[model samples]
Target: MPEAALPEPVRKRGRYRRRLRSRIIVSFVLLGFCLTALFAFATNWARQRVENQLVEDVMNRNLDASWQSYARSGGADVMAPVQQMRAFLIRPDMPDRLNSLRRDFPEWERLQDGIHNISGEDADGKPFSYKVGVRKTPDAWFFIAYDMSQALRGEQQLKRALFFSVIVFSLLSLVLGWWSASRVMRPVSDLAARLRAYRGGNAHPEPLAPRFPDDEVGQLAEALDDYSSRLTEVVQRDREFNADVSHELRTPLAVIRGATELLLARPGLDEKVLQRLQRIQRAEQQCTDLIGSLLLLSRNERGQGSSNVARVAEQLLESHRAQLGGKPLELELEGERDLVVDAPEAALSVALGNLIGNAVKYSQEGRVLVRVGAGMVEVIDTGPGLSEKDAASLFQRGYRGTHAGYSQGGGIGLSIVSRLCTLYGWQVSIRPGDERGVIATLTFTPG
Candidate 1:
């Protein structure tokens, strides 16, 4: 059977069976079916018992009457009963109670060996059963036959009663089910309305209404409300953080941009001015890198969008290789297949770029081998690497190690990578460089 349509209450109360009416309906149907089956069994048992007793009574009576008749008349023909009609031999009350004379019922007559027979009705008034055939003495007989109109009438009454009961209870169940469903659905509908207001196209966590504090439905509402309210608080905190990022980054960028512009504006300014411009430009780049890392952190927090991991990684590696400027990054791809992950392509690029860039920046100008494991990316640089202190918190948001050296980014690169990896179920770990510099590995998100 097709499933019943979900009631409005279940939609509000829960995604499935959460209404009192649903439970009651299910329980009632099961109970009704079981009771009906049991009733049928009991009725059948009683009916069969009564039928057996009735048959036994008739058999005994026939045996008694036949023995008496035979003892009195040696082998006399059985008497013709009431109505005296020609349509039947033993009219009116045929010798239905006697077995031997049973064959002649509705048309009975004694036969040889003191036995006779007659026909009778089935449960449904259809002619289907045969009456008894019995011997009264060594050579005398009697028989009986009749219709089952009484049994048929009783069965008909039972069927009608069962039908009426089902109709009445079915209607009763529907009314009860509907009312119970509404009662269960009330709080849920109210909660949903409140949720729409709270979410407001964003995660605006709102506290639950305090009116109902301890009921089951109330508990659910309170939990959802608490979550929404927490969401709003978190959003506020993030806004503050993003604003702080902007304020912290503007000063250095302004200084570097202004210094570079002033010297470049005046054509052919001297060699000393040109050299100063280079340092300013480098500082400006570092400030931009720092700001970028902070922005990447926000994107990772929000799960902004998706990206093609394999394509993005390949592109970033190609760009980083060019910057090697003669020192090669020995590349090793562990698998023949490409790996895909649902993440921001730019964040992946920036993260991988930072690890490789750091390797190049800190190394003693040597080869930085990059290895892509089955589920990870490893960057091993040739430089005098970190101590235990540095490795412990190397990927902390702002903590830089003693040997981290001054890099373009303000220490947020590895942190962003770590945060993103955590959020997307990836793994990230680092150890001292392979007898050279740093070796950082980021396990890609499992597909």
Candidate 2:
């Protein structure tokens, strides 16, 4: 289907539903979330590194302090006191005890002076984790163990808290993102509202740049002001041009009509000359109707004039009947009566005339029917059946059909009809008829 067939309200609703505000909000939210998540990750990593360094430093200090205490006591007592730490003394001469140490940690007695995590159990048969250190003294060796289970458990708790913090802050980012988007979009929305409210022709639009901040939105407002000024000027010029042309053309057309009437009024005129004069009068009348319709279109206004749809169809059929040349064709008007429309007679005449004219032109030997009833008028033509290309682009301006070979038309007749239908809130569609013809429908709101 053509876009012109879609109701205006539906198109407007579709455009509104796809507003940029929602997209802007979503973009802001995603950006905030990504930055916050990255910051949280970096913070957690740095904290973990500092915590590990502090734990190692504390272990080394405890080892050094206990070693000094044992040396001061002259190695008399092998046990050195330390909080949350256990010290062991091993001699090279004690075979059974050293073998027991070897069984527990074969490499403990030969270890160097650095911290190492070891798995073990306390005397109470509870599993424990410890950071152990080994030192060589003058008389014997010392093994110092620092219980690390508490510290490891505290680290786990901190990890849980950090993960929870990431979640909380991410949620906060979402709220902040929504607020920022609203603030950013408010100016744009106001500008759009102002533009939509301004009507042309007599009312001037207010200057928008002064009301907005000095940013991208302000620049857009300034651009819109300039465009509005230029567009208004152009529209004014077009209105003046149309008025002048319509006036100039009408004067000559009126003279021709008057002269043709006088020639017809003369007594004892030739039948051939009378026929030519009558044709000239009809042409003059048609030119006047065309002028009125064009002026109305140029002004983009709809006027209310009650006209019977069937009566107009009948008159149009009569006009086409006279111009059929010698073709064996039949013109008929059918369907219900009193189907009035709320539009000017020239509007209806131009709209219906083009359709009937096209039917009479292409059709050679079959009946052309105009069916009028209710809120619709259907023009059925047994012309060369419409091709797919023609049916799709028929009403487009300057688009001639494949069967329009050598025809005396500029191909804007249907385009004008379509424009009139649009201006009057009416709908028009042209399609290939069932079996062997074409159908053009003009549907109007019921009067």
Candidate 3:
């Protein structure tokens, strides 16, 4: 069968089952990554803020101490306060000191009374960074430079470490997500497997709740158990009812058959009366065949036999002819006469009978042809042409077609035919005929 012929619900179900587990795993991995990345960003920001505050405080305090020492010494002291600190002093009367300051720190003359950051290469062509603190009095000006090269190197090292930590933690998150996904999905997978095992119709299936703990999965299992119990009860009751009905119906049909046979045996029976009696016999036989086929369907079992397709078609056409009366319809049988099918006579009769009956019932005039070929049969009718709505839903139980006005049927005949085809591994299709009416084809060897 072509994929385009499959029902919409079947295709949607296939897509959903394939993606569910993978979607769960992908969700977990994404959540882990987002949380880890957020933490890394916060940690880096806080470290940079605290380190800048501490460096500024130390530079301010040292500048104040150096100016106080020079004031106490009566403007004569010129020594540095710390190993990483350099002090420079200039007075208005000292021309030589001003000239020396200009040659060494040219940009420092315009400094205000606060710390400022500066970086550049020295005379040795090596890169250096420092914080310069300025203090000015009416008598003298003092400048303190604090070297920050060591602190800059330490900050670079800390950044490198944090980068590696981020990589390591992200990888850890990936592994944790994978493990957690497996653990979470195990119970769901097990439940699905158990349900699949019970699909072949177990007489008494094992309880699922007992195998799982008292959680969400356990609740689901318990609910399934309740539903299964109710379904099993319903199916059993239906089977019993069908068996009882078939038995009761056969008794009356058998009596009718016996009465008709005895009447036909009489020597002086009138022609008209004999024809009526034979019609009664044929009706009884048709009812018997229908009951047997329905029983097999209810039991979901297949019957075994080999039947000649041409012979069955001819018999069906003859039966329909007797019922036609004054109707202007022609019934014909054509194609291969020796084609055989591997199915019971009653099953074949019920299936083909429904097709031929529908053709005769719907067509007002022209020919109803039954063509038998190798492994297949086609019932062509000059009935009112099929509509799209009828073609789509004709085989559904209780669905009457748009043109089925006043027809004496509950619409289950075609439904039964569809089930029989499924049980026997056969294929059936209906379409509009070439010029007019409908054509229904049934293939035994569909593969």
List candidate 1 stretches off by more than 4 Å. Answer: 1-34, 44-48, 51-126, 130-137, 141-146, 160-164, 200-206, 211-214, 226-239, 250-447
Best by lDDT, which number?
3
Candidate 2 lDDT, 1-447, residue by residue in tens:
232232234366556743676676677667766776677678778876786687567666766766776677775554535566777776666677688889877767667878777767767998778778777766677777777788778777877876777677667767876787678888987887887777664646678999999899999999998998898789889989999999999999989998998899999999989877887887787778778888899899886687889998898898777777889999999997889888878889899999998999889889999998678999998988887778768878998889988989999999999889889988888878888778888899733
| True-structure lDDT of candidate 3 | 0.84
Indicate the TM-score of model 1: 0.46
Clashes of 1: 25
lDDT tens readout by residue for model 1, 137-231:
33433443333445657767876776666666666656765676677767876776776665354544445667555788798977776776777
Give the best candidate by TM-score. 2
lDDT for every model?
Answer: 0.59, 0.80, 0.84
Give the alpha carbon lDDT tens digit for every residue of 355-434 in model 3: 99999999989999999988899999999888887877888889887878998999998888888998998888888888
* Candidate 3 local Cα displacement, residue 344, angstroms: 1.3
RMSD (CA, angstroms), candidate 1 = 12.9
lDDT, residue 174, model 2: 74
lDDT of 3 at 343: 89
- Alpha-carbon RMSD of each model: 12.9, 4.7, 4.7
Error of 1 at 380 (Å): 28
Candidate 2 Cα misplacement greater than 4 A, ranges: 1-20, 54-82, 86-148, 201-204, 213-215, 266-271
